[model samples]
Target chain A: MIPCAVTGIGQTRYAAKREDVSMPELVREAALRALDDAGLDFDGIDAVVMGKAPDMFEGVANPELFLAGALGAAGKPMFRVHTAGSVGGSTAIVAAHLVQSGVHKRVLTVAWEKQSESNAMWALSQKFPFQPPVAAGAGGYFAPIIRAYMRRSGAPEHIGWQVAVKDRRNALRNPLAHLHLPDIDLDMVKASPLLWDPIRYLETCPSSDGACAMVLSADVTGDRPPAWVHATAMRSEPMLFPGRDEVSPRAGAACAQELFEQAGKTPADVDCAEIYVPFSWYEPMWLENLGLAESGWRAVDAGRTALDGDLPINMSGGVLSSNPIGASGMIRFAEAARQVRGTADAHQVDRARLAMGHAYGGGSQFFATWLVGTEPPG
Target chain B: MRPVHIAGIGQIPNVRGDTDHDEVQLVQAVASAALAEAGLHKDDIGFFCSGSSDYVMGRPFSFTMAIDGVGLWPPKRESHVEMDGAWALYEAWVRLQHGDVDTALVYAYGKGHGAPVDGMLTAQLDPYYEAPLGPSPMALAALQARALIDAGRLTERDLAEVVAHARRLGATHPGVPAIDGPLDVDALLDAPYVATPLRAHDEAVRTDGATAIVLSVGGGGPRIGGIAHCIEPIELGLRDLTAATSVRRAAAWAGLEQAGSIDVAELHATYSPQAVLLRQVLGLADAVVDPSGGALVADTPFVTGLSRIAEAARAVQGGAVRALAHASGGPCLQHNLICLLEAR
Candidate 1:
């Protein structure tokens, strides 16, 4: 495969709502910052790949059609990608392929979601002519799965709180995180109202309005250290099937396994990880699903994934903090790259060598993963 | 990177509406036929990508149910685009370009019959300034058509002659829907105008259907002749309506100069005048043009551009054409895509 590198990254100050800027202005803010970080201009970008959640989230159909100009994709080959929630990660992967395939020297990847503009729950719960309605929306779809995990793994309810407190505390260090709860704790999280039975409001990701962009190049084109892309993979399964495991999704596991194998590393060797955790429980759940932890998710409760412990996960606060639906996965990817580039200030992992970034959507079936390293792998 | 080939193509006869089959079933039948034609199974596909619009389906994530048609058991790598099927094919082709997967499946489906096809199309226009005015997409196209007519670059007679050819060509085809015999240009012009200066034939019917194409990597599939696609500015004011600048851009990208002499060329002309403009734009006057009719007859929404590619591929595989096929989208051909196919 042709070599690729993450040369620049930019993200907006995520929040519950950003009425100050329209969709175009919001996306442009991130795009311009990314361009500035890359030390390049609009003419320098060879192509643009845009990503977002379902069109209903924005009340716009095929957003990129109208967004082409603001994204600096005018009169250029612009591509749009939608792979459910993992769209951001897939969007980045698509842009990377343009560079990796020698089709383009540089590609700008952008993903954003302004959920405040529209009700995502109602949007996602659109009643089709024949399809069954998802009563609880995303949380309802995932709550039962969370219960199944509790039953199968025999893990205590406190494990979810541990993850929530850890990520919320991590958000204290991230200036861009949406729900930065500097004073939150386990008891506080347990007290939050339950939206989807067993899944409290605090346990779920907050709806946020934000954008994220990254200018990826084919190898380090300048003196700046590049976050070399080692391997990238994506996988998807049926939304609902008889034997599907919703808690530790097979798609996620297979994606991470193949990605790790391609990058020639094991879960233990990963210095840091940036997994999608829109819900607090997903931290422990995906930990087992990603093979970073063994069969049951005991690793999370054992403190093996603590910041100062064996593996540092979501040092950039993760989706639990920001949760810009379309851009969350890519934020994970960008943050992972930043850590390896030694550009992450407050959330940097010490002496990070390799990192893994992940995102999933479509009832936890669609998955995208990428491995990046400070030193180029042989 | 591996050279990806178009192994098989499948599409139903494109009429304005196909009420006989549900959209999902329609998509599934075509996908099944295309796979079996290539001697492949649903299990063989390593990648899956589809294109369709939620608005067209009157719901969000319209293609979600269609994913079941693939029986995504092993959870293959997949993606979707709210674009024409041809563009979805482009995404699938990009995945194949990596040499990571050998096969990619791409499909698109949208039914414009139930939805406010006209008003819904306007949504694709500039939402902030253009859509608010409610300049019906056809009315906007007519404005550009009037400019082309006033420029003396095209005439009403030219438009009718193009439609006459489209009707005859469509009637003789094996699968094209038969249109009412030969229309009168003067009568058409004299006919009440829906948007002034343009006749009903000048407007495409509200079409709904699905199309699918199978792509194989490293020459493992059918030997595709050539593939070329291009885009025009989304705004009408960006270019001359009479001039097919986007078609020229696509032709150049397809290496029209190096493609040598051709046997047949299928052009997607939703409107007869577009046929005239496309001929001038793609310079296909010397080639065998749309023996299987054109968009004037069997115009499907979203999947129509893909239908063009499939029809041309069938012609080439049948030893009928050794040249190019064109497809397009957006109002006034605001967005254009061209594919050059050859039988080696």
Candidate 2:
């Protein structure tokens, strides 16, 4: 396999609604930024890869076809990937594969979601004929899983509140984050309304309209420093079975395990991580799943996941701070790249050399992850 | 990079409406058949990928449910594409190049008969300009057909001939619904136009179906010579509708010129005129085209593309030396993919 590196990264300012621009314009904003950051134009790109959660989110099926011109992908190999919420991370990984496989030298990948166009909750809760109806939205479905985790781990309720406050505060430093709560605190999070049992309104991710893009190349070609991709992995399993473990799903663990093994590294070598934390409790659940912490809630209670902690997680506020659904995973991946490249601005982890990005989707059945470092792999 | 081959292919008979089976069952039947043909168990498969659309199912994350058919007890490496399954095959091909996985399972399923497929396809158009106008896929294809006629590049007789030939061949394939009437060119030309310059015979037959293909590295099957795809601009006004420039570019990239003479060409031409247009663009004058009747007879959404490649591989398995398979997406062939296969 050929070596691949991320040379450019761009993100849109996430918000509940981006009414000023159309979907094409919304994606073009991030794509143009990525191209400019790479010190190249559309002519330099060899192919384009796009991803989104589902076409129903925006009432547009196969949006990549209409977006071909907007992405400057005319007369180029354009591809679209969809794997539920993990689509963004998978999109980036597919783009990297185009480079790693020696098929294309320069690849531009983008993932975006315009949630304002349609109600994602309603779209997700649709009932089909001869199938069980979805009685609850995403939060309602995951709340019981959180309850299971709390019972299994015997963790205190305060762990969820603490995560909410920490991530929101971290969002204050990220200018592009959707929610910048300077006054966020444990008390405020505890006082927030309870949308689902064991899950609070503030603990949930906000639905935002945003996009994220990256320019990957076989060789580091941009003027900026490159974050060499050490390894990438994706895994999937059935959504439900008789003995499936909803908490700490095997697919996610296997994905992360393969990722680290390929990179020849361990959790200790990872200085920071950007994980998919749609809800506050998932930060701890995923920490254990990724093998970042032997006792995930214990790590959070000990302040080990704090911004200044030994292994700072979600330094750029993560999916909790700004959730665009589809782009959230790529945001995690891009933030990890930013940390290792020393270009994370105010959210930069001090002397960060190695970082990890992780995402999961579809009842925690689909998983995608990548490990990146400052130095190229041998 | 490691060499990849089409080890096996599986497809269910196309039907207008399959009320008896759900997406999972449809996928399971074909996936099992393909794996059985490859002589491999689920444990031997290293990766899994599928192509599907949410609109066809009228639900989000529809592909998630299809994984149950593949069985994820050990949690396999998996991904999906929103486009045709042909693109999914391309992705699996690229994944094989990493040399970590030796075999991959690719499948696609669609229930187009459950909904107004032509009207649903309008959602693929530009939302700001075209979708609001509500031009059905047939309408778009008719416009392209009209442009070809105005350019003096094709006539209605030429289209009728393509449809006539496809119908005669389609009658022999069990997967296609048997045609009941005369298949003469004049008879096809006399049919009422569903859209201007395009009769019902000119459009693809919308059906519900599923398809699966197994790809392996260094396996005993038809070796993949070259595989590449390209896309054209979205705006219809900007392109010369008489020609398929993207198809020419993709063919060049796939080393079509260096592949020497082609023995068979299976094209995913959703419309009869496209088959004529592609034949002219790709310059396949001597190759046998659509030996399995192609998409015109059984144009199952998302499955037609992969079925074309499967048919091409089957042709090679039957002693053909070299073959070409083409899959297309978007209105009027805005996106095109070509896979070149040869006997090992």
Candidate 3:
């Protein structure tokens, strides 16, 4: 594979509703920032790759067709990657493949979701012929799984509230984060309404509108230090089937294993990670799935995953603080790159040499993860 | 780039509509057929990728249910694209280049007859400006046809001739629906015009179908010489209608010059005039274009472009020396893909 690096990263200030700009403008905001960070213009981009959760989210169809002009991809090769909620990370991987395959040198990849245009809850809950009418959309589907995880791991109820408080506090450090509750605390999280049993309203991610973009190039060094890509991996399984382990999906575990093996590293080598924790409990669930915690819930219970802990996760508040569905995964990826490049302002991990970004979707069946480092792998 | 070969190709015959099978069954039949033809099984597929549109199905996450067709029991490594199936194939080809996966499964399906086809296509336009107008897809194509007519690029009779030729070529392929027999240019011109300067026959015969292609490295199949794609701005006002600049750029990137003499070419010309413009842009006047009637006869929304590559691969499998396949997306040929293939 050709040596590729993340030379530039960009993201918008995520919010519940971005009524100020159209979808194109919202995406352009991030794309322009990434291009500027790369010290390049449209001329420097060889191709464009876009990713989104679903067209129904924005009442648009095949958005890339309309977005090509806004993305400065006119008369250039462009592709749209969609693999459920992992689309953002999957899109970045596809763009990186173009460079790794020696097909294109510099590729621009963007992922976004403007959830304000339409009700995603209704769209996702639109019952099919054989499917039941599940209420509350994604939270409803995942609530049962969280309960099962709690039961299986015998974790305390305060664990979920603790995560909510921790991530909300971390959001105070991130200017672009959607939720910045300065007075957030464990007591406040416990006081919040229980949207789903074992998953409080405060623990759940809020629907937001946002976009993230990155400029990936092959062996192209810019003015700033590049986040050298160490390894990237993706895995998927059927959303529903008999004998499937929904609580601790084998797909997620296999994805992490393949990623670390490809990078010639292990969980111990990771200085930090940006785990996709849309719900508070997912922090522990994914920690176990990624093999980062030997005692699973006990690891987070010991405060070992705190910002100042041995391995920091979601220092930018993560999907808990800002959940733009499609852009959420790419945000994780960009944050990891930021940590290694020492560009993450308030949330920067001191002397971080390696980091990991992760995302999962479709009933936790789809997974995409990547490892980035301050130095290129030998 | 590592050499990628089209080991197998399969597709269901295009039909106006079907009430018997769902999207999953359609995709399954073609994928199973293609894998069997390649002498491989699901276990041999190192990577899986698909292309489909949610708007076409009037639902969200359209490909999610169809994932059953590939059977992710072991949780296969996979990805997806919302564009044409040809783009999915493009991703698979790129994956094969990584050498971690020697074989890839690519599939695409579109149920064009599911909704009001013309109106559904309008949703792919710019929501802020173009979608509000509620312009049917034919009306947009009409604008392009009018420009071609005014530019003296194609006459009404020329359009009719192209359709008549496509009907004849389509007659030999069982997958293409039979049109009224032996249509002459004058007879076609006499037909009612659905859009100004574009008769009913000028538009592709709308159908619903699915296609699958298995690509592998160093296989006993048609070797992929090169594969590339390009796109243009969506706004018609910003582009010159008579020129397919994206096609020209894709052709250059796909190494049309080094492809040598083209024996068979499957061009995805949903509109008859596009066939003319693609020929002009690619300088394929002497080449045999669309031996299986092209999209003008059996166009199946997202799957049509992928079917072009399958048809071209079939030609190379039938002993053709060199073949080129083309797929176009977006309005007025705003996006284009070209694949050059040759027998090993």
Candidate 4:
């Protein structure tokens, strides 16, 4: 396989509502920034790939067709991917494959969501014929799974509150994060309103409008250092079946195992990671699923996931600090790329040589992951 | 890069409405048939990809539920695209080039008959300018047809001839309804217009269906010669509606000139004018076009594009040496993909 590298990364300022720009303009902002970062223009790109959660959220089907011109994709190969919340990571993986497959040299990938236009909750909770109604939103659906993890691990409730406080506090270092709570504490998080049983309102992700973009190339380009892609993998299973493990899903573990095997690295070699944690409790659950932690709750208790720990995670504040649904996964991937490139600024992990980005969606069925390093893969 | 081949193809008969089966069953039937034809079990396949739309199912994450039909006990490497299944095939082809995966399964389905498909298509248009005006797909096709007529490239009688030819061939394909006796061009010309310059027969007969194709490396099937796709500007005013420049570009990139003497060409032209336009653009005068009736007979939304490739493969299986297949997306052919296949 051909080697691929990430030379440029761009992100829009995450907010509850980006009413100032239209959908096309919103995506163009990130694309242009990424192009500028790469020290290239639209003419340098050979293809464009885009991903988003659903069309119902923005009232437009196949929005890529409409935004082709805005992204400077005219007279070029254009592709669109949609795999639910994990779509952002899948989009990045697809773009990298285009380079890795020798199909194209330079590929521009983007993922965005404008939740302000329509209610995502209503769209997700719609009743369909001959099917049970999904009256509860995503949080309501995942609350039981979190409870199951608590019972199985015999962990205390403070772990969720601790993660909520940690991510929000980290958001203070990220200027683009939507929620910059300077005084976030465990007591404050625990006292917040309880939307779902065992899931507090402060532990939930916000509905924000944002976009993320990256420029991938087959070889190193531009004056800046590149984060070489070591390996990428995606795995999926049935959403609901008898005896399926909803917590610590097998698909997630398999995906991570394949990714590490391809890269010829182990969990101990990873300097930091950016895993999708829309709700605070997911941080611990994914740690165990990815095999990064033998006991997830114990790791949180010992602050191993903190900024100064042996394995720092979500240094750029994660989905909890800024959630755009579609762009959230790519944000995690881009942040990991930034860490390996030593461009993460205040949130940078010390001597970060290797990093991992992970995302999962669709009732914990779909999974996408990638590993990047400061040095090229052998 | 490794050589990719279409090992097997399977599709259900297209119908106006399929009330008996849901999306999961539709996927399971075609997937099982394709895998059986390839003599491979689900465990042998290394990668899986699907293409579908949320609007068709009236729910988000619709593709998530569809994976249940594939039966994921040990799980598999998979992905999904919001575009047509032809693009899914393209991604799978790229994956095969990575040299890690050997076989991939690609499938797509759409329930177009359950909703007002034409009205729903307007949502794909520009929300700020075109969608609010609410021009259905036929109206947009009429604008292109008028452009061709005004350019002196075609006449109303010529479109009637295209429709007559499609209906006659469509009768032989199981996916479409059989025509009664012979089709009359004069009768087609006399029919009232659904939109100006476009009679009811000029448009496609929308149906609900599913299609699956198994692609493998170093397999006993038609080998993929070259495949490429390109996109033009989205705005209708920004492009020359009378000409399909993107198709010309894609065909050139797919090595149309190198694939000497094409025997069959299956095109995803949902409207009569598009068929006429593509033939001229791709220079397929000597090739047999749409032997399986084409999309004008029975268009199944997302499934139609992949079905075009499947039909072209069937032509190769029937002793054709070389064949060309085309798949399109967006109104007025905003995006186009071309695939060339040959017998090994």
Candidate 5:
């Protein structure tokens, strides 16, 4: 595929709650900010692509129809994608294809969630016939998987806590991060309420109401100092089967391998990463999946993946902070692009040239990833 | 831009209710037929996109269960849209434009038999303002039909002719339920008015069905030509529903006449008058239209529009015609899509 670029990025002030604004207002703040960041306007955008988790979460059958007016998608070619948790990344992939295909010059991509609007756990529980009724929240479904991960990798128990603490501490620097735990520490996360045995309430992502947007452009049409899209890829497998590995699915691994292969680089070339970490343990879990950790060894040892460490991960406080389910994935991609464009303020990795954005959803079976670089890739 | 094409097309016979077969079974039949037509295997495609609505399934993530049809054993890079299957084809086209994958599978299914089909369409209405009225799609379309009648572009006999030809043609076409021939226009206009002004014949025979199409970049599929899609706002009050916004929008985007010319045209017009409306809205000058009876005779929910694209592809692939195909969605033809195809 031809190289696409991310020129502008925008995000709302992540908070425990955003009450005064409607869902569209929350999304508009991010989109307009992205337009401003990209130095472009509505006229410059040729099309729009929007993504979110599921329509049921918002109580709106098709949230895209309602959001059409607010997202400035009145007449232009507009598309809405729902790919479970990976929708945010999928949304960006769809938008990037518009530019890469030369179908649209500049495309506006946005994903958002008003988790405060509805209970996701309840929404996901609306079951049908012939399906398992194990809808004990996403964490409950993954706790057993985490146990399997622990047995397979022989990693210690404290690694998950390390991830929660590092992400919370990093929140202090990102102005847009939702959960800014100034007093966060290892003991605090361990002491937090245990929602699911292995996943603590504090370690879990908050039901945030926020939005993220970005302006993706072709190389020739890029207006701002663009985060040249080095490579983008996505992969998915069935949600469950006899042989499917829930903890570390082949889909996520294949997605990562393809991401780097398309970029003509390796995981070591990545300077920072904004990975989907809805729960603390997924931090180290995805580390090995992304090929950062040694195979079968899934812990961020050697003080890596920290803000000051090599391959810093989730400097935006990640899903652990502001996890507006649908927007969570796009936020990761937007942050990576921001780093490549050298526009990341407090969370910026110093002299970072390459960054990665990653997301997985639906029983850890679906994955979307991209590698962005400061320089354009041939 | 790489020339995109339709490598394969498949469809299930649109039935009122396949009581013996479920949605998954229906999807499987269509997928197998399309792949067999193109001589392609499931693994040969890199991207898979499906279109269906949760409202129709009466459950969320409705498309998840339908994957059994594709035999997605190893799992594939797949996505879904809460819209018509025609839009799924559009999404596939956009992915190919990125110049990444060469081939894609686009499929859609509508379970009209799940409940009262007309009641299901009520979900498309505005929940706050209009849905409370419980205006069934037939009645709502009748409103627009009234406006067209008042304007004198059509008369009582014209409506009947559309239905007569549609059903008569349906009786001969395979997969179409045996509808009888040549009802009177006045009789149709007076068929107790299911809503008002618009009669039963004005609407297509509602049925449960599934359809699928295989698309390739650079016209690499069995058939070839131009493919384009453009969508309008969801609000009917926002635009003139009486006009064909989708057709005009799609025609302009596809550069309908700019490219080599169109020799044939097919559109998803569930309502009889819609065919006439699209012809004028798209300014399709004397194209060989709907030789297969089109949507008026038998409209198969979300798959109807994509069926039109497949119909166009089949014609070109069979050396029957060389031209463009159009599809539509939304209430009273709110959204429109146009694709051009040619022979090798």
Candidate 6:
């Protein structure tokens, strides 16, 4: 595969609502920022690849057609990728592949979701046959799994509270993050209302409207340092089958194995990670999934994933701090690239040389992950 | 781009409604057939990509259900697009160039009867401008056809001749409904206009179906010479509806200059007048068009584009040296994909 590098990154200020701007304007904010970051305009781009969670959230079908004008991508090759929440991550991977395939150079990839335009709760809750109706929303679907993880790991009840507080504090450092709870603590998280059993309102990710963009270029690194892409991987499986493990899906494990093998590196080489954690428990769940820690709860208790710890996670906050669903995964990817480029201001981890970005969706059956480094892999 | 081959192709016969089978069942039938035709099992595929629309099924995360049909066990690398399966095949072709992957499976399916297909399509227009007016696709195509007529590029008899050719071809296909006689231009002229300047036979038949194709690098199947897609802005009023700039751009990128000797061409022309416009853009006036009746006889939104490729590949397998296939999406042909194929 041809080597590709992330030369630029941009993201919008996530919030519960971005009423001031329309969907096209919301995405242009990130697209122009990324173009400026890369020191190039739309004229330099060869192609554009877009990703979003679902069209219903924004009430548009095949939005790339309508958005091409705003992107200045008329008469250019444009593609739309939809892989559920992991779409953001997969969109980047597809764009990178275009460069890797020697088919395009300087691909601009963007992902966003204006969830405030419609009720995402209702949009996601489509009743299908041969299924119980008890599972109401996304929170309702994952609550039982959190309980199962608590039982299986025998972890303390405060682990979720700790993650909520830690991420919220990290959000204060990230100006683009939606939540800036400087006074938040473990007590406040535990005191919050329990929307789903074992999952508190504070422990859940807010419905945010935002976008993320990046410029992926083929082996033509200008003067600025590039975050060399070491590996990219995606995995999918049936959401419901005979022996499917929703809590610790084999798809995620298989995806991580392929990603590391492609990069020719292991978890120990990773300086930091930006794993998707829409809910607090996912921090621990995905940690174990990525083979970073033997037990996620134990690592949380030991502060091994803190800002100054052995392997800091979500240094620019994470999905828990700000999630626009579709753009959440790309934000993880962009944050990882930022860390390697030495551009993650205020939340920078010292001496960070290697990082991982991870995202999964659709009952944990779809997974996309990538490994990046400051120095090109041998 | 790295060279890729279309090793096998499969498609369900186009029908107005496949009422008994669901989306997964429809997809599984074609996917299994495709893999079987390639002499491979499901495990041999390195990547899986699909294209589908949520509005077709009237729900969210609709394409995820297609995994059941392909047997997503032991986990597999996969991605999807909300467009047509031709776009999915384009993604697979790109993935096959990564050197790590050798073979890929691409498929697309749509349920046309669950919702008012025409009304749902109107929603695909610019939401703030065109969609608010609720102008049906036929209405938009009629407007385009009117422009073609005024420009003297097409006429009522020209459209009737196109329909006559499609009906003649449809008669040969066993499953497709036969358009019984009275096949003269006068008969076509007698049919009432569904949309102004577009008779009932002028518009494509809205059908439900699915298609699957296997793509491999340095392996069996018809070799893909070039595949590319381009798009135009959805601002319909500002753009030239008479000519498909997107198709012209995609064809040029897909090596249309070298396609001078194409033996066969399959076009995704949902309306008769579109066939006229696309033929000019592709410059295939001398080549045989729509040997398998094209989309006019049966049009399944997501599947039609991919089936064109399948049909063109079948022609190449039947000894045609070179073939071209095309697919379009969005309102007034806002997006276009063109693929060039040659026999191995």
The CAPRI classification for model 2 reads as: high
Better of 3 and 5 by lDDT: 3
lDDT of each: 0.79, 0.92, 0.89, 0.91, 0.77, 0.88
Write one digit per residue (lDDT tens) for candidate 6, span B31-57.
999999998898999999998988877
Q: Worst ten-residue run, lDDT, model 3 chain B?
A: B112-121
Q: What is the DockQ for all candidates, taken in turn? A: 0.59, 0.90, 0.81, 0.84, 0.51, 0.79
Off by over 4 Å in 2: none
Q: Which ten residues in a row have the lowest lDDT in candidate 6 chain A?
A: A127-136
Model 4: DockQ score: 0.84
Q: By lDDT, who's the top model here? A: 2
Q: Which residue pairs in candidate 2 collide? A: none
For all candidates, the clash counts are: 0, 0, 0, 0, 9, 1
Superposition TM-score, candidate 2 onto the true structure: 0.99
Among all windows of 10 consecutive residues in model 6 chain B, the one with the lowest summed lDDT is: B174-183
The TM-score obtained for chain B of candidate 2 when compared with the true chain B: 0.98
Candidate 1, clashing residue pairs?
none
Instruction: Please give, for residues B199-229, the per-residue lDDT of candidate 5 as tens digits.
Output: 7678887777888998776544445455566
TM per candidate comes to 0.95, 0.99, 0.98, 0.99, 0.93, 0.98
Docking class of 3: high
Write the residue-wise lDDT of candidate 3 on B114-231 in tens digits: 5656766788899978999998777888788788889988888878888888988898897787675456888888888888888778888888889999999997899999899999
lDDT of 6 at A157: 88
lDDT of 2: 0.92
Recovered fraction of real interface contacts per model: 0.50, 0.90, 0.82, 0.80, 0.46, 0.80
**Second chain TM-score, each model:** 0.91, 0.98, 0.97, 0.98, 0.91, 0.97
The TM-score each candidate achieves on chain A is 0.97, 0.99, 0.98, 0.99, 0.96, 0.97
Looking at model 2 chain B, which ten-residue stretch has the lowest summed lDDT?
Answer: B174-183
